[model samples]
Target: MGQGGSREFEGGPEGFPPGSERRSARQAEEAPQENAVVPTVLQWSQGGQSVYVTGSFNAWGERIPLRRSGNDCVVCLNLLPGTYQYKFIVDNEWRFAADQPTVRDEMGNINNCITVEDQTSFMREEQPSGFFDNNQNLYTQALPDEITLAKEPPQAPSHLWCLPLNFPPLCEPHVASWTLLPPLGVTLTHLLAAAADRSTNTLSVTQRVRSKFVTMVFIKPARGSAADARLGPAPAGGQAAGGGFALPQLPSTAAAVAAQQQL
Candidate 1:
């Protein structure tokens, strides 16, 4: 009922070389007799300095790096028939291609999605039709049963939990505190999942939690100017006065938020 659930998805027709793949949304309904892997290529065309993709295939653990192709970054993978939700990390920022199919998790976090169908039915559909584009893909929409997986795993359990706005994460202060603000000139409102930078030793907390704003906070550095403390509750013995926010709740005023910048 756990990772075993993922196996049923991997059972499909054998995949061909990348150039031999077929693409269509209608072919999914006809489960022709086939058994092998499916070749999947994920592309990020938003233009970023660096891009990598990660999702359900690897339990959302390791990010598969994408190679640059003109204005796009692309990666090809051998996946079995299944539904997967993924987003690209563009220049260390979490983002999804809005033009593609998307699904939101329980927390309203959105990610680009792809569905790989069996190869047999897919190959059979191209009966002497005009040649398909060299870059055509086989992504299809989810069937009834597969829709349930949209929420199966987006983030790990630690960051999956939701806390109401202004609710304290720990009774005492955490690391240093940095206010969260939307990127300048950004208007479309959407949720950004929690992420931590190990090299910078910074933790970002973002939660909507009945609030309209997708607010976030950068846990300040407990050390000197460099924030060296990890994001979490205080140490075992006692609380550190400078570890968390001085205020009982986050700043809520328009004046307070308008002048802020993300850490």
Candidate 2:
């Protein structure tokens, strides 16, 4: 299991490292575009079945009560700009999508995946290198013995969980039986992609996050009615404060222009 780092990264008070060369390079690269501010309603047809949709967004419901929306077990989530992994927990059994798959959990369960683009949900305020900070942490965390990367792409299945960003901390940490140790000097872009890939394939950690790439929800596929499922209003769950994957120490300050964005 990866433990939390005691010290923040040492850049400066504003937490942005000082430099123009790397900043300029990042500007040159193409990142995914932001499509909307509010999350568009996402719908899927399990067509007349009760599928329990759960993930880190919902504290990995010990039993996630699915929502009944007509014929589908509809769930809603508000996510930041990034990738997240999820799966369908159908009829009490965990399963990943048959397409677009990746790795397995510490308990040896595989998961399905989804990606929410950059600046989607949590960009209301400006914070430099928000997601990228977690990207750098992947390199620092100690790797478990079980995780390994797949040689090919994975599959995905469909179900729904209406996970909120402020989901409670999972009491039990989801582990990766087959984990991947990232190589040295990896960038945030590649790190995010890799974490997303892991969500499809590995067991989850207890830490909560909302990227399209990494989440936990895999269940057995069966035919049934979602209408039979019961769900009360979600607890007053709040969104995560941006703690994700592994994190390096935060920088102590920022450059002048970057510092001004904080005001």
Tens-digit lDDT track of model 1 for 108-208: 67877898887767666554444344444534564555453355455544423443332443343563344333232232222332345444333333433
Worst 10 residues of 2 by lDDT: 157-166
Candidate 1's C-alpha lDDT?
A: 0.54
Candidate 1, residue 8: lDDT = 23
Query: What TM-score would candidate 2 get against the native?
Result: 0.26
Tens-digit lDDT track of model 2 for 1-263: 01122222222112123552244335324333345433623343554344655443333433344577776555666654444445565543455556454555444456555565555346566555743454655675676685555365554322111122124444444745333332222222221221233123222222212221223323211123242133322234321245222333232334433644677
TM-score for predicted model 1 compared with the true structure: 0.34
Q: After superposition, how far is residue 102 of candidate 1 from its true place, in Å?
A: 0.8
> Clashes in model 1: which pairs?
12-36, 13-35, 13-36, 14-35, 14-36, 174-243, 175-243, 176-220, 177-220, 221-227
Candidate 2 runs further than 4 Å off: 1-44, 47-49, 62-64, 69-71, 99-103, 106-108, 120-263
Superposed Cα deviation of residue 115, candidate 2 (Å): 1.6
